[model samples]
Target: MARKKRIKIYSSNGKKALLLSPEEITIVKNDPSYEKNYEIEFNKGKQAFEVRNYYAIGFWKDLLFVLIGAFLSTIAIDYFISITGNAGLFPGGLGAIARFLSIIGANNITISASTLYFIVYFIMNIPLVIFGFIKIGWKFSTLTLIYSIISIFFDLILQNIPYINPNEFSLLIDYNLISSLPGAWGAIIWIFAFAIFGGMINGFSYSITYKGNASTGGSDWVTYYYSKKLNKDIGSLNIKINIFILFIVICLNTIILKTQHIDQTIKLSAIYNEYNSWNELINSDLGKALDPILSAEDKVSIDLFNSWKNLQTGNWNNEDWFNISKYISSSSEYDSYYTSTLVWKMKFKWIIGPSLFASLTLIITQGLTVNRLYPKNKILNLFISTNKINEVQQYLFSVGYTNNIFIWRTVASKKNAWNDQEQDLIMISMPLLYFNKIEDYLIKIDEDMIINIIGSKAVKGKNFSYTFDNELREKALTEEFMNNGKLMKKIESNTIIKTHKKMKKNGVSIQNEV
Candidate 1:
């Protein structure tokens, strides 16, 4: 018998591998099969060593895309708030930032809620972009900063534009026209038209910014960093972060209400309304029947009823009611008769609207990215029978698992036969989104095929991550061009030239392939 001899080989990392015999080493040096294995190993190493360029495209085009996305997001925010009455519908962290700013200057300056919201939003983004710089990259951080600044100006411009002012636009619609509709129709319209549409618009803006390797700042930065770090779904992480922020905002709002004496004003308004109701009751037939039995000179009831009736009829609308001497001397009466009568009603729709909007927006956007957000690649491994392997592999490739496949033949002991059976075990790494389709395909090929699904927190090789389908993008562009042919025609030349130059210069690779 010939003695077995081993030839040691060293990996690029300097780790020695006892892999081949003397004859195997000779084959490895000259055989095509060995060359193919070497190429695969070399490519795997290259993937680890190659520096990933975050800004794969030029800064100018990316800046334009980020700006457009930011502008659309601002529009969505304004429209959502205007239509929903601010009941807490501002998306993401803007509401909490706005409320915090308001609390900072509750006494000194009187700023419009809309103006304050945008101001706080822009200011808070300054620190947030720093995190983007550290976690993401320079290009991403710079684009986010630009987006924040441009969006602030864009929001201000839209607020001044009377024709597109969300408040004015919503008011122009006649709710009375839809009054004959079902009671729930109003709610349905508000949710579907304002909430759902606004959420989708915001999601589109986010997706666009993400495609350009940028973010819109605020909770976006938080979500991005933590999602990468924790290897969790971006949407799930966003919900947790926003919920915590929302809780803080609610606490701060309660404190503001207490400190500003707004709660007292609300109580006073309720009391004033009650006084008017009593006055009307006294004037009714029931009161007339009871008046005879009541004690004479009931000053408390008389004063309240008389004061309320006088205010209702405008008998106390004179300057004498504003006189300092009367105010000081009859302060208690003055407060009940005039102070409480003054309207100091607070609209909570602003608070509630933004909260709802932020929550819903996170849910929609996260749902869209969940399947692709994992850091590690999920794979479906199969110990498929050799006879059905080709059919199974082709079916999977057609569905979207185009690469990352391996196969090997092995002998298996037969239960009651003299000969052993040959079986082929196939392995494939695929995106979780295609799991169901692959499973269904496999069932058609062999119902008893051995299968195992394994999830990883990190994947190192070529990744075919889920991305937006080109068919959808093409359809959207076609519809837009058809709807506004003249507008598209005017910009078509410039758009094509710019796009071609950018793609060429940056060596931009398209992710989605037919």
Candidate 2:
């Protein structure tokens, strides 16, 4: 048994070799990462490494953060998406796409929209999760999987707490103008309210998921992957993706509206399917007269009736649409034939009209909030003019600061200061949090120190960096305590260095490497 420790040498490319024992492999096969990364090939006789190494470093803490992230995401789906969706605002996201798809797929499947949303969302993530695991790392994809699974569970429970909808909304303070459409059929959309509140919740959900070292799955996997691969800001990439989704929604919206219009104008609409006597109604002068109830409201009769009726309905002119509108509007006046229809089409039907503005507002708000909330690769270039340079440097690149070795450079300006000749400008580039910690210390020492900080879009470290020996240390540490001591695990920070963002000849990076 003691001699069998080095038994299994599964796959070795020599340069990046991982030696895992058969017993260890059996244990790690149960790990989430094992199932995610190696399940396909593993079942086919291929072997996997100690995926447990990727975890067991403050596992509980990570789990708590991930659960909180999941809870936030669930709230966004159950409350924000649900309410905004009910209001019929095409708030673009994975959820919106899922909802629309569910509507189409619902007739064939015996399931609710919310449950179908979870399925569609899960299906959408499968490919991306694989990509994330292969390209990004195990921790990210594992956390993402955990987050999504937990979110789905939480959503199923929360979705049952029935929403209360009064179906009344006003665009502004005025009740008479720009209220509901021709009839109260289309609820007057509270565009600003929906966009702001829902956008905020949605944005926070995304941010919290990010903070937990995971994503909300779906497009998030691609977003994080491309953000790292291309070294673009996450918020900027999110805007582009969300805009594309919105564009698709707009196109789909137009197609649906056109189809509905055609059904109403040419192919007998469901409301008039029972009516067999079109000629009898035409001969009765029904097209000339208006419904008494519709006439009772002066706003509908004088203000919106004619103009709303004149809306572009494919090849039909103002006169044609007016005649058709009159024919349709007057049908409700006759109760003997049937309790007929006075149709109210979609409110703010044009996709590029008020809905576009609302969608844009929501996405823009979401993007800005993400950028502000959980900032990554955020570098701070500091030029501290102080006489106590030694004290400042001690506070900055000192050994006692963290467990990992500090690697930083300060370009000492030899020239004397204009006001204070004793002062020197020490140009250093570090992260935001590091700069924050060194703030009050510098202030306390040099009461008149002028510190100028320039921020970067996305940053990566230069030659001076701390790379944790993730593999070797992972094995030795886990073997040592058997999950007893808290290991100083590698910091898997996303430091994407691309284009001009790579540490320039002039740019210094006081960052870490994992």
Candidate 3:
């Protein structure tokens, strides 16, 4: 009789092999005849054998997810990253360099902000793809390559929008919500809002692609690769990158202040919304130039002058200039510049303030998100002090924690060590897969057993050593014991372990791997 039940299985070791571009999956039920004989056969031809019990890597679901994630990444890159990096320039980095190159490309060759970003970013991902292939696996690297190509295709389509400018699309939606507030608050909110949105979408984009067995490329590749070599959280590595970008932002702004700061006055100026300015700029001779804080029907508010905007064209100056700029206090020299006509206006300094807040917001949000979704693939350390040590120890070993166990006789501390009876202290470190099953069994054996479980951030044993740092970038692909660690094998007793869900995020103590 054919059985309808399906059991999940996979060849973890074979997955890393070169022949499997994507692993193959098949369903096989329990059988007895095939087990007694060796399955492989060779006779000067391709070998054939009954794979009575076999499994392959599950890549179909992740492949579909990667396709969908590629589209989402397109949205994140085109809408938020392009808008914030090209238009605002607060959290400047390689994108700013692209925007600057686009500005000079205005002579005879005009490249849109989106196009330039694609060119710059894609060139950087080639090596990362190779690294992924070598370190991660052929399957993961192939999926990432597919995801990157699909996202690039989507971007190519979006870049064809009439304006070919990312901010031009954002300009279609006016952002007067908080920027309309009085004093420096408007400027502060303006940059903060963009940074928050940009950082969040970017985070979600990377995480989603990660779940799809891919990445948003660039820093995602570098962060994960180094996260292993350095033994650190991927989010923390990203924080370092953002902080470095902040330094770049400051340096670039300093360059602007020193080289291009204007001390002159032109005709009268009216304060137009930043959106209106981008709208007018995208259609002008300098239409493709993403640096457009001064390209509107009239002048933008003093507070909206981000560091990248050249002040000379319509820099507000002259004695009649409003004195409202003094209301804002700025420690950076880039904040305010005196005009030849004796006019003083706040530079708006959207650079430093917004970059700082965006960095902080990203650090917190990304950290929390990773912790919730991808707690490290860890080995849990069980510390047990019990009067019924023999029963607990036997049950623990029977439940599959047979390796790396230590026992010591100990006495009660608070009850007066000399007078109290001694009990054995049992310690074992094993994968989280067997944790709940063993814990439940221990509880049944001795309700009074005192147990403490501490998750290890890394693990190195006789045969294996790996750190499945559950960051936005990795999967628990190397959880070795999940397959051969006794619970998976049929035992005389019918005690079965269920599939484990994600680990708890909020409350858990994690110790260093030993």
Candidate 2 or 3, higher lDDT? Answer: 2
Candidate number of the best TM-score: 2
All candidates in order of TM-score, best leading? 2, 3, 1
Q: Quote the positional error of residue 366 for candidate 3 in Å.
A: 4.2
Worst 10 residues of 1 by lDDT: 320-329
How many angstroms is residue 47 displaced in model 1 relative to the true structure, after the best TM-score fit? 19
Which ten-residue region of model 2 has the weakest summed lDDT? 488-497
lDDT of each: 0.51, 0.51, 0.47
Q: Write the per-residue lDDT of candidate 3 for residues 198-233, one digit (tens) a residue.
A: 555555655666766566665666666775665544
Give candidate 3 misplaced runs (Cα > 4 Å): 1-56, 85-109, 160-172, 175-188, 229-238, 253-351, 359-367, 377-514
Model 1: lDDT to the true structure: 0.51
Candidate 3: how large is its RMSD? 17.6
Residue lDDT tens for model 1, 1-514 = 9767754443333432334465644533453343454444444433322223223425666777788888877777666543443223434465455645644553457744555566777787778877777766566688888887887788788778977676466532432233223332454354445555566667677666765557777787877666555544466556676666765665455444421222222333333333234355356443343344332336335544444345445465333222222222222322323332232222242233333444455445533543344222354444455557777765555444545578888776768989997777887665454464346657778765777666645545434443223244334434534465543332332232233334435664321111
